[model samples]
Target: MTEQRFSRRRLIAVSGAALAVPAVARAQDVPAAAPLHRRNTMSFVPQNWQDHFDGLGIAAIVADTTSRALHFWSGDGETYKVYPTSVPRTDELTKRGYTEIVRKRVGPDWTPTPNMLKEDPTLEYMPPGPGNPLGTHAMYLSWPAYLIHGTHDTRKIGRQSSSGCIGLYNHMVEELFAMAPVGTQVRII
Candidate 1:
């Protein structure tokens, strides 16, 4: 285990329910006494540790889709990378039949249907076969069948092809594997 400065507060709030939008935390420079005003339909709430972990920490996520680019953000927005693959949402995964996802290191989950995924520190890949999709590295989110991992099918990279998991190139996933910790927040845009 590594030392992490994560907030127990956010963990507590999430324990109550999985789907609620966890509060977005604000910067320390902002005053707690002063309330932030919203100018649009989307009201701005204070971002929590998780929010800070996103744009300003070791976390990463698939921010969006492009015709060809599979995007990811890591290292306080300093590391930007893209791969070729389609990411599946909980709804889509549920449609396919999986409803529970468990991030091994993270308890419970946030998706409507849980999809269990886990990192094999032992370098375990599913199906126990050659060229398995799990690749050399992985970030196994809760969806039992899904994961953020490398791809042997390089041609499928940058396309919406996976059932509900995020795909990356072999080298890219390996790099990401080295950077993200077990607790790093992964926001699939």
Candidate 2:
């Protein structure tokens, strides 16, 4: 057998490639492992407004807890957007069905729900600021204490981390808050 030699650079490249092969193969094992966007949106499902709404009255929003995605459509059907969201932490905390946006607030204060307070008496009222959980904007739902809002904790996005609200990235919520009017129809599923 003839002796073969490898440069130091060549050895490292070969070793690195060899180490990466298994990781790449493991990633491909799940054929459905794909990202819908730049974020951690692995389970996003493309939704049609027609399936959930009777009509796009002014604007419509559908928050899909199962997919951890929020879908929005404008009244004229000209604007459509999808956003990954943080859903309620448990099915028990989830309130499904239809509701309308009753109000909008910028720099919203966060008051823990009665149940939330009961569970954690340490929780105190929070005024809107950098430390507030409601991020920068909020759109209240017809249902009491329910909102489509933004979270300061970005990790909460793309995960089931909310008490009952649907959460978006602060930037996304700011955008949605601008596009969605107070009367926007909302559905949670």
TM-scores of all predicted structures: 0.46, 0.84
Model 2, runs deviating above 4 Å: 1-17, 20-41
Model 1, range 1-189, lDDT digits (tens) per residue? 998765888777777556443443335556778656534322222223344232434555442333333344555666656544544433454222212222432111223222233322343334523356655666776445456767677766655566566767777777766666665555444
Error of 2 at 63 (Å): 0.4
Name the lDDT of candidate 2: 0.93
How does residue 169 of candidate 1 score in lDDT? 75
Model 2 clash tally, residue pairs: 0
Q: Write the per-residue lDDT of candidate 2 for residues 16-122, one digit (tens) a residue.
A: 99999999998776567554344545478889999999899999999999899999999999999999899999999999999999999999998888899889999
lDDT of 1 at 81: 61
List runs of model 1 lying over 4 Å from the truth: 1-55, 66-70, 75-77, 88-91, 94-129
- Shift in Å, residue 75, candidate 2: 0.2
User: Candidate 2: how large is its RMSD?
Assistant: 3.9
